[model samples]
Target: MDEKTLTISVEPLEDVKRRMLASLRGAADATARHTFASAELMSRTLTPARWNILEAMTGAGEIGIRELARRLGRDVKAVHTDMAALVTAGLVERTAAGKYLFPYDRVRVHFEFGAPAMAA
Candidate 1:
């Protein structure tokens, strides 16, 4: 089985329009891509603590809140709250067994700042 991956990026509105047009023209497949208008917005949502949670969960298999907290040396309540945010973001899911898991086996984050001249 292939490991599913989530791509995170910071892009402008024009890039979004370009991609939409390409998809409409049948020149590209409309794959799911998560984007934020700026890196600051992305960082705000994916905080350092949450990033650690995700790192610990990816490919680690389903894990109960207590166990996940133990692995991170964090409080279960805190982990639970972070888990909820991740779930809402569609980055993680809860199992019937009361475990949380990052559905994707891998995650890719991409960001680039064009030259200052192009920033205009």
Candidate 2:
């Protein structure tokens, strides 16, 4: 089977807008990307718990919240809360059957910090 990949990135809002415009114009690449306004926001959204959830769900197929919690050895309520945040971030999806899924087989993160401007 072909691999599905998702890219997570910290990008300025303008950059995200440009990419969206490109997509509307059919000029964007096929890879799926989820962009955060800043590294801080990305870190806040993808916490360690959420990251663990993602790791557990990767290629694991649709799973109920209770089963997922059991697999991760976490409380169901806590897992559910993390799952809700992930779903809001578009990193996770809730199926019609009320199961959760991380559709991508792989995840790639891309970001960089530019050097500060030199003072005169």
Candidate 3:
């Protein structure tokens, strides 16, 4: 067998350290941020392909419809269909690379609405 062994220890915090820990431990954690209602950034207004395009753009940070289709395992026509919708919605931006720019912060409203969020 090819293997290695390692050990680790845990430390318990004291008063001031505990206070700092509390500050770091936010009341609104991942659960709150990712809630269906709160985390529902993509608009239902999008067509299915548009949704796909949006997801691809926001997750992959700008790529052409052909490449997007390649990643999506779909046809270029299909990907473009969605891209058209996404562009109309202003959720995805076309670039010189025939790619897209997500512009997530531009569309985010505290809860990240109207644009597809990072991969779930």
Candidate 4:
């Protein structure tokens, strides 16, 4: 199976603009990217609980919510809540039978911080 990755980043507005223009010109790659204006936003959306859910679901095939909660040793209600957020974020998908799953075999989060430029 191909090892798909999810890259998370704090992208500046200019970078977003450039990517938008590239996509408009049909020059953007097919890779999936999740960007946030700030790292705090990313952390809030992709919480540790949600990350655990994603880790358990990755490449695990379709699984019912109860089964997933059992595997994660978490409450069904909590898992369901996390799954809902993940689904909304486009990180998790629901199968035809209403099972939840993550299609990717791998996840790689990318976060970077650069020093502010010195005065010219």
Candidate 5:
């Protein structure tokens, strides 16, 4: 089976708008992309605990929150809270059966900082 990939990036809103317009114009690629408005936002959303959750879920198939918590050795309530945040961020999905899934086999993060602007 082919490996599914999710691309995460920090970008300005204008760049996101341009990309959306391009996609509407049929210039879209097959890969899934998630863009954050800024690095700080991305950092805040994808915290270390959340990253651990993603790592555990990747390619793990649909699992109940309790099982996921057991696997992570975390409290069910904490896991559920993180899962809710992840679902809201579109990084995870909730099945009809109420299980959680992170469908991608791989995650690629891409972002860069340009040189600071010089004042005249």
Candidate 6:
């Protein structure tokens, strides 16, 4: 629950692709399929750096550009670039308060799988 204090190691690019492929192939059933589909779609829309910004912004709610940079362990200018990219992609928005936030309308990716007997 304490997302701020949580630190996750970035997996290698090969590992990321492998995991994604595995997630795609090993989907348990329909619901799981859809969930993984959403993750994949989201992941594709993100650059590695942009994904970091999303994780940080998602965890912390609204934040300033400086703080986003600090959380990402990058300098201001580098994060400035990431922010611009995310903003352009519509994954994040800069508010009137001069802080960045994920939009209230969260994204959903829909895919139906399997048959009537089970959703998954």
CA lDDT of each candidate?
Answer: 0.85, 0.92, 0.51, 0.83, 0.94, 0.61
In model 6, which regions exceed 4 Å deviation?
1-45, 104-120
Question: Tens digits of per-residue lDDT for model 3 on 58-83?
Answer: 53555766777898889989777777
List candidate 5 segments past 4 Å from native: none
lDDT of 5 by residue, 24-117 (tens): 9999788989999989999999999999999999999999999999999999999999999999999999999999999999999999898999
Give the alpha carbon lDDT tens digit for every residue of 53-110 in model 4.
8888777878899999999899999889989998887778888899987876767777
lDDT of model number 6: 0.61
Tell me which of candidates 2 and 6 scores higher on TM-score: 2
Q: Could you tell me which 10 consecutive residues in candidate 2 have the lowest summed lDDT?
A: 28-37
* TM values, all candidates: 0.78, 0.91, 0.45, 0.82, 0.93, 0.49
lDDT of 2 by residue, 13-117 (tens): 999889889999989689988888999999999999998899899889999999999999999999999999999988899999999989989989999999999
Residue pairs whose backbone atoms clash in candidate 3: 62-100, 63-99
- Evaluated at residue 92, the lDDT of candidate 3 is 57
Residue pairs whose backbone atoms clash in candidate 5: none
Return the clash pairs for model 1, or none: none
For residue 58, what is the lDDT in candidate 1? 79
Q: Which structure among the candidates has the greatest lDDT?
A: 5
Candidate 4, superposed: residue stretches over 4 Å from native: 117-120
- Native RMSD of candidate 5 (Å): 1.2
Error of 6 at 85 (Å): 1.0
Model 4 lDDT, full chain set: 0.83
- Model 1, which residues run further than 4 Å from truth? 24-32, 117-120
RMSD of 4: 2.2
Better of 4 and 5 by lDDT: 5
Go through the candidates in order and give the C-alpha RMSD of each one to the true structure: 2.8, 1.5, 15.2, 2.2, 1.2, 12.7
Better of 1 and 4 by TM-score: 4
- Model 4 clashing residue pairs (backbone): none
